[model samples]
Target: MLPRGPRAFSQAAATALRPPSGSAPERLCVAELPGSELAYFAEGGGGGDGGRPPRGFLPPPGRCFSFCVPSGPSAGERVRAARLHRRAEQRLSREPFGPGGAAEVLPLLAYAGPSGSRPEKGFLVRDRRRLPETERALEDLVRLILPPPARLLSVYEAAAAEDGGGGPLWRSLWRLQGAPESKVLLGRARVAGAAEPALHPAAPHLLDGAAVFASFEAARASLRECLSVIPEAKAVLDLVDGCPVHAKKGDFPVIVIEGLDATGKTTVTHALKDSLNAVLLRSPPPCVSQWRKVFDDEPTLIRRAFYALTNYIVASEIAEQSTKSPVIVDRFWHSTAAYAIATEISGKIQHLPPVHHPVYRWPGDLLKPDLVLLLTVSPEERIRRLQGRGIEKTREEAELEANNIFRQKVEESYLRMENPACQPVDASPSREEVLKTVHHLIKKQCHFP
Candidate 1:
């Protein structure tokens, strides 16, 4: 029988009720209740108390609700009603929606939908079909910026694709697997493009061939994996052959003798060259013969330039002679620097630019002497030697003789040169003693004996 009055109660009951999959009732019993919609209860079974809620709904039992739909007076009808009521009881037993309900359900909702997009860009969306095209693009880019036989490309790609924030763009471009020279070229380009002020300011100064090559190789290896993902990377790959560092043979054993005036350096160097079977050379090569006279007469900044330029010419001559024999230089770059520094100390003139400073010559390119002998003489001994020589006085010589304090500073500077190859011979010794010391020191230091 069905009892009914309220539509809301009937709808709730209808939605909650269900029958076991393959069951059917013999006859349906209907009832009409007051003030509510139809509510049916089977007459059979202990569940006849459908007018009241289920025992599971009683206080302290966790409140529950139940609905019943009476079946016809047949065994199947009774079974169907019992099953529907059981399902309703189960539904009402569950806890009602609460604060954490939304959180608990959110994951389930997300699982039912498509995954969301990434927030940032510039990522490789790798699919097997696109890999070949992407790789080809990257290869082409690498060739554009780097020369043939890309030795560092693999390294670059690896660094570029590294996870854990391991790869930086500079590393990828420069340190890729490629020829060292090519890597250097690429590294320069990348460094030039850096946004940081320090990197930008330092790039040009730091981009030497050796440094470039090293950085490029490092960056490539570091960014290698990332490079593989950049599909348009071909722009950085191709580059034309450009200038490269090359080695040239030059005169060996160019021994340059340098010291303050009246040190007997010229006489000692000439004698040493003769004894060693070495070619005696002088700075301000004969090619700049007139400039040599100017330097001796004027000692001004202009004259200094002439003297400096002459050293290069002498270097050229020595380079040519080096193939045939070792060259001994009476005075070379150091003499130029010493005189320039001395002049500046005297407050007589402004100093030369660092590039003009003989010490400022390219460390890799300058002519390295096999040995240098610095003749040291006390001021008294040096002045005495000048008197003994009967040499005519020049204005510079007169000034030097007058200023003993200034002269001491010059001597001190020479002594502090710190060049390992310089050997100091005491000029106060007897001529024979000096020669013996020179010969012995040379044989020991140069392994000529």
Candidate 2:
């Protein structure tokens, strides 16, 4: 028997003392009292049995008392039992234990623990009020934990602070994580704090909308920088692996002349190709050249797809040759866009797909030409030129000829293109005069003597 409350004998002792098997034991018995409480007694000990009655039976002590409450908790027992369980939980929640049921308490421990003492110890704390202390701890921990290559803790800290308001200590820690060096840190910080979320911008010089385009440009610049860091031959080989355009081993200054028919492109390209010692390669090139036939026989979506596919093949060939020789292309990607846009203007098509659509690709990734000369001629002049060429009209050609309106729209679209690579030349003058101006521009623009 034991005193009640904290000193009470545990239920294990009582269970051990009970006989293992019995109907009720004849000498010693345990029973429930009135309100479902337990009582224990020795029955025949007073009988003075000279023989030992039961080997395991010990004489009951005087004034034996109850140990635990008799009844197990009933369904109706709510408040009292719940209060006890909650108290136990609260006590356990304050300590640090290994992962499992105890791991959940770590965040709370972090919040409640002492401030700024053990820097590593304080980092787990997430409370806003405790952030100052936590930040200081993180900085110290970073120095201890991070190797040189991985030490961007300061940079992270600075970036976080710029993005949203936090404690000064927290911001300092972020800078340690986010930006270790000044130049790299500042650039990242600005990018992180920019109005728009972009990795790169189209034009770094144009601050007004630069942020809008930065995401793409930043990624491109990063890739380029990474490539530059590698050995040149290795980088080129890697580029070839990723882009089919680099498969050929040739060094040529490839000039691709692109425009609608009767834009004086053929005349200018022949002259330019001769002057530059370039090969005049035309799209729908001899090999895999079905698009030209499609254009002549069946002008439909299928034809468009064929034309776009052949152009890519030709572009790839040009890119390969560009390694060694100067290659001139009569028409390239610009013609693709012009024709697609023209189809749309005629109300024959709506919503042209993006440049990378399987049917067509934007030539943006193609090898950049040293120069692109765009011949600009008025609708009337173009019409006259077409008539003078004495070429049989296709359906598209007839449509453009019948409605000067369509021709004007196509011309306007071409002029409005935003690529910096193209230089427009007026084709109203005689072919010879126009070619001379073009030759002069090329000499100046491309540094040709």
Candidate 3:
């Protein structure tokens, strides 16, 4: 349901909330949202008594669409953003993109230009299995997502003056090939040059280098750039280089346990270390832990390289120690790539580089673990654990709660790798029980004595 209130009600908002005029999803999923959030779905004309969204409304794909929520209700706006984002996630999980299938949907948040005019947003329907099926789906999606530019224009006053309002700000759409260069052109607002209204084909300058490292050398250059901003990060970089790469692969197995904060990964890892008589090592090894937080605050490229470099450092440790006994690791490249990929993109999972994409592939230079045990827990349980721990949450931990899409993508990306795929372990069980289960898996897989 859209929000209800005389001020909030509008024909454009209502129309946009529904599946565009002619296209309707095969099925509509209805979930029980809290009564407090009812206002968001209730806003606009014809929500009637129940305040539900109009029938035929398939929850918009995992992208936020403008005109979905009526403007000016700050509290309602926040609540609706959360709900719509969740809805988008729901749709994406249900309909994953396969080979030749399009994975992303774009919901442009159009706003009034200088003089005021409408704009558009869209998505492509695709399937690797059938061309006709793909075409039909794409058409339905395009029609269903008919963005109400007029409604966005109606609410465009506050931001217009600052950005320099004009007419339809842009008219362009980029092909979403599911790659590093992919982009979604949301509605453009007014800008500096009013004499000519040209389309902005590129994504925002801030996102230029999001979640990417063209090569190790590129990563090094970018790392140096970040270090220049924070002198302390340079020290960490030096310390990582201080540890020489191991000359030979270890005789014993190296196992890595990874999961979000409060998922018992730390506890399980230490226990496994003792049980397996294994040496415990962490990425951003103890030598560099001092600056882990420092680099964590820096932008994506630098932060990832810091973690990536730590893996090489730990690889050195693993190679040396596994000669004597097994090596147990707390985190590794999976953490680095997953968080990087998730943070770099917005909206649906489809927007992310698909599974098996090169960006998701493990780095060639870094040593691969004998087995990577990835821990998983439900969102409700993960939150409960975080609250119980009472420690200051890391930025990543905080984001896990703040953005559902980001959190989901991180876990998905972690499990998507193939060079050394992550084996999912349910961490929701008792710590002792989880350890026992993982022990069985480790012993069976590693043939550990």
Candidate 4:
């Protein structure tokens, strides 16, 4: 244990454990109100059926949310948990075939044994419609939060504090173990149980809610507070000094080109830089490049935080460079949010938040590009381009090639962003054609001469 938490920011994160919202059941373990002492296990349904638990209810330790509260929770924990539960229920209720449907739900488990302090795990309830692929993704989530040989117990009708109160109702339990090398595939993981509890709100954020970070200031404060274990704290701080307090606007046109790797992003960005006499930039700006791989090795939240922070650094640069000439970026928030949101949602575009949803909107704080050009290439061509690289592919790139659904989800996410939305261009044509198309879009969208 990292000797963490009596409050929100601990050496690591010490979990604030509590019982469910409801009272204990017959022959069940129970504790008094605020149930911080212990969580009770019962053998009865909320209905007075007196039906025993589907199986024996093992009195496992109550699942504590370190993010919700540091150690022992204050009133803040209940409020936060309630807020999250509301969001989750709303999202789930809107979800296709969610509640009332015969859709089978699988419980997700997360566990960390006093290792690094915080328990980095996510819990979710996934439907069984997609079968094998979804099944594999669920397995990946399990391996992500709790790797193999760390079996999870499937408990049912487990009471929740909300059920006791009027929180979103759900009844399920699962055991989990942490795996450092684990890379959860974002969406649904198949735990072998039929009890589909409501999804955790942060499920979409997935562990650290890195995708939720839109403002640099918020991200930095959180990073400093929660990420004491980061390898180069002083270096990170010094680097932060160079970034603008907030994303600033400049006089010149700012165009961001976004696409998967080998989708001619670099080529198009370079061309735009030359053609428009613009400054070319890439995210995780070279200034913060030193920290990319470090955070990449950590969990999803930390890794995403690094990228999120890097965007701020780039924003500062953009503020400066745009004053000199038009700025063309190889990738920007489009890439970050698109990939993050795409990874968060399961199945297809339909499952994603609707166009008007806040999740699809641009961060109010970040600098917006004058125009964002999204390059699209056919799957076959993209694969061919990847082969030509003769370079090692990133995990995401490999996933792009292997999972078409993932690719579509990413593209859809890009299209859904508001407040300076990304415009699509077909990169399937010849390089000259692609360049011409981009130039045309810039002139039309940004009035670039």
Candidate 5:
């Protein structure tokens, strides 16, 4: 059993897991905070009349987050009897319940244990009297911190902190209330395309079958459903209808260039096009590209479906282009799937769908690339290029700079892609050198002169 008190508690929490990455200073958990039960279940358990939780209290505890790592009395059995003993010295540092004052909050983390509680993590924000301002601030923070797929409706309320201060601790209400229906659909699986049955329905990104669309037909169905609500989807649907079900590579090779932003994809693809006299194409295929931002702002279902269909349209283009000369694509289904999978799952690289999970398999009906090259640069070099470009970064691009884990997941997704997995190329050198290396690979792989 873990020891109690401020010093021992701090050491135990620190040792329970590795300190979080990034350069943030270490802050210890409050001593009296104890664990999950003390923080959440004490003080009549938020009940008033008839022992029932108040209205607006999130229900079905499965959806709620657990706060503490199992330890001490809660170590071996259920922690129902443990109670927090509040001391005057252990009260929270501040209690900002002023009409319009901001309150201090802390981000919390808990380990998954054998007792079946999943690992839980999130921020605890103070509830405010000004509802509108509080809502807007929380929305902004959610957008900044979480990817679209992971965002959920939050619950805010007043509660008694274990220290006897009537401080509030809030958590996001997830999966049901305000989340997109597609989110529920996405998480229904074990992992996109996993053959094993999904035992845990509430698992966040451990989705089964497909993350976005399992097949082209599935993508078409989602597009058709969103036509009335998302008008821009009509263009995508029309492009899908006209495009062939499968695009067979023409007489020549179809080469695709892929990487994170500022990895010199534009420079290298253009150079390759010029050298090989290849027809260059990009997905959403210029026709639907104009509406890229519109769909990007939509839910993951609409966003990913739009991009997936664009790959089919590009496939048709590839068939035609390759017949005349070798084809070069700026980005294809690889970029679409890599970014989607990375954004859908959070935390470390290990949290990603297992290696060669069906999520990484190429769609059978879509045109497969003869060769896909992933451009890689040293982190310093990548940052240096981003600074030199002087263009605004996309949300994911900005995240790449701030979060190493997200960036690693994206690149790793590319590597794990099956069938026509990407071959990593060191792009840290000059543009000419990178292009030279790509040309050599294409010649050897495609037998192109």
Candidate 6:
């Protein structure tokens, strides 16, 4: 329910939250509010016998909205909050509605959890006149957004600010209930005469394995189930099925090269292949390259599974090739998990799962590399190289160019992996220097003569 109180909510705060009038098309506007500040605002509006927020304190129509808590009251309760926010934002942006009837998706407001943690929710404010439309949209959005294991409880609808009592009031017309945890939190808050909704805890960070993959085997099984839903999965899976899943590692060392796009991975790996006389391979290996675009468009779960399964196929190839020569992989599990984790967790790098978190661990069953080298270049140099290539960028590569937070998260995720953690290699230097440096590391680390 929208918070209300007799003290009259601050007009200044409302004005500050309002979207600026612009000549451009209607777009989603992100509004940031600390849980503490929101609670203070809600408490200031206190009224009614039940000690619920008092009515008639909201600003005028089109400007009234409330932020709700994620499902689960306790801080320890875990939910796919980041993914849920992302999925909801994606759905809402697709719809033709915003401040006006026609709208575009805008960047989400930064709402940090307690003590500046990952954002708990993404808030969208719609015109009250389109309540019916908003309700229908919410229903459809929820249908697509709630795919099980996601714990979003409800999407509350706020009435147009109504004039009564002392000031305008924002009322909760209704909530499309998806889970009961939200109600429990609200009930407790109301009972305690607290204004703030239950603030989510700071732990769980960005990469919660349970929220995505508990294990490699579990991810593969889930991918199979999603095959019916995402037809692209079959084409990608066919490539996976052709390879031997259980292959013995050959005598030679298997080295993986990891980095963001235009980070000299191709140049370095190719050079290493010639210098070391090693067999070259890559995930989403040459076999599935044709279908890469098809699965890239799929949902996060399906897309990640696609890439992950490819590694196993690559693993089989590595086993075979390593018998004759050293194996140099363009990208492998580190690339897969780094990109997936970075994309899944929104906001700053700090929002990423804590260092040494289980999500950063190497899969116990997957084939392990002898040594992994992560090539990094300054952002400016990376963009310069990207321009120099003139090749089409992968989805993540494109995002890497534009989103610093995302790029940082991917870099950090690469650094955080345990067991076979990646060794950093500065690729900012000349291509020849970079290769020479890598050659030294490989011979030193892999005991190559």
Model 2, TM vs. native: 0.40
Residue 244 lDDT in model 5?
Answer: 81
Model 6 Cα lDDT, one tens digit per residue, 1-449? 33433223233225422223432221111232222112222211232223443322222333333333343332122233334554676566565454345422223333332344344444534344434455455555554565533322322222333354323232332333554322222221111112322322323533332233534565566466655555766766666677775666788999999988888888988988898888889886888888788767655545676787788888889989888889999998888888888765545566667777877887776778899999998988887777867787677888888777778878998999888989999998887789888988888888442
Candidate 4 achieves a global lDDT of 0.52
Worst 10 residues of 4 by lDDT: 63-72
Error of model 6, residue 192, in angstroms = 12
Instruction: Evaluate model 6: give its TM-score.
Output: 0.68
Return whichever of 1 and 5 wins on TM-score.
5
Q: CA lDDT of each candidate?
A: 0.38, 0.39, 0.52, 0.52, 0.56, 0.58
lDDT of 1 by residue, 1-449 (tens): 11122232233333332323433221111122222122222211222233232110112101111112223333233223323333332332332212321100000000001122111000111112223333333333444433343222321111122233322111112333443233332321110111111111112211121011122222122222223433222222111011112223353555677776678777787787778787888875654454344335432322343444445556656777767766778876556545544443321112122223223232333455666777888888787777867766644557569866446544544554444335677877777788888778666655332
Model 4 CA deviation exceeding 4 Å by range: 1-210, 447-449
Candidate 5 vs candidate 6: the TM-score winner is 6
Model 2 lDDT-worst window of ten: 62-71
How do the residues 1-449 of candidate 5 rate in per-residue lDDT, one tens digit apiece? 22322234334333341223442221111111212111222111122123223222222111122123222222111111011101100122233312334533433333222233433333444443333444444444444334454454334333333465432322223332243232221111000101111221112322221234557886776567666666887877886899887778888889999988888998998888898888888766778757877876564445677788888888998988787899889988888888778765544466567776777888888888899999999888888878867776656678789878778879998999988999999998887888889989997899553
The prediction achieving the highest lDDT against the true structure is 6
| Best candidate (score: TM-score) | 6
- Rank by lDDT, highest first: 6, 5, 4, 3, 2, 1
| Per-residue C-alpha lDDT of model 4 across residues 82-179, encoded as one tens digit per residue | 23333333333432425664222322223222122222222333333323333333334444433244433222212223224311112323333454
TM-score of 4: 0.60
For residues 1-449, write the lDDT of model 2, one tens digit per residue: 11222112222233322223422322222232222222222322231123223111112111111111011122112112222223333433443322332222111000101221110111121222222333344344444343333333321111112234331110111223334222122111110111111211111211111111112222123223323322332332343335464234254455666566787888888887778876788876775442254334432322343444455556667776666567777766556545545543222122222223322223444445666667887777777777767776666668677766555545554554444335678888998899899878866765322
Kindly report which residue stretches of model 5 are placed more than 4 angstroms away from their true locations once superposed: 1-210
Against the true structure, what is every candidate's RMSD? 37.7, 33.1, 17.0, 14.6, 15.0, 9.8
Off by over 4 Å in 1: 1-252, 295-299, 346-364, 388-395, 418-421, 447-449
Error of 2 at 129 (Å): 82
- Residue 185's lDDT within candidate 6 is 24
Per-residue error at 163 for model 2, in Å?
A: 68
**How high is each candidate's TM-score?**
0.39, 0.40, 0.56, 0.60, 0.60, 0.68
| Position 118, candidate 4: lDDT | 26
Model 5 local distance difference test score: 0.56
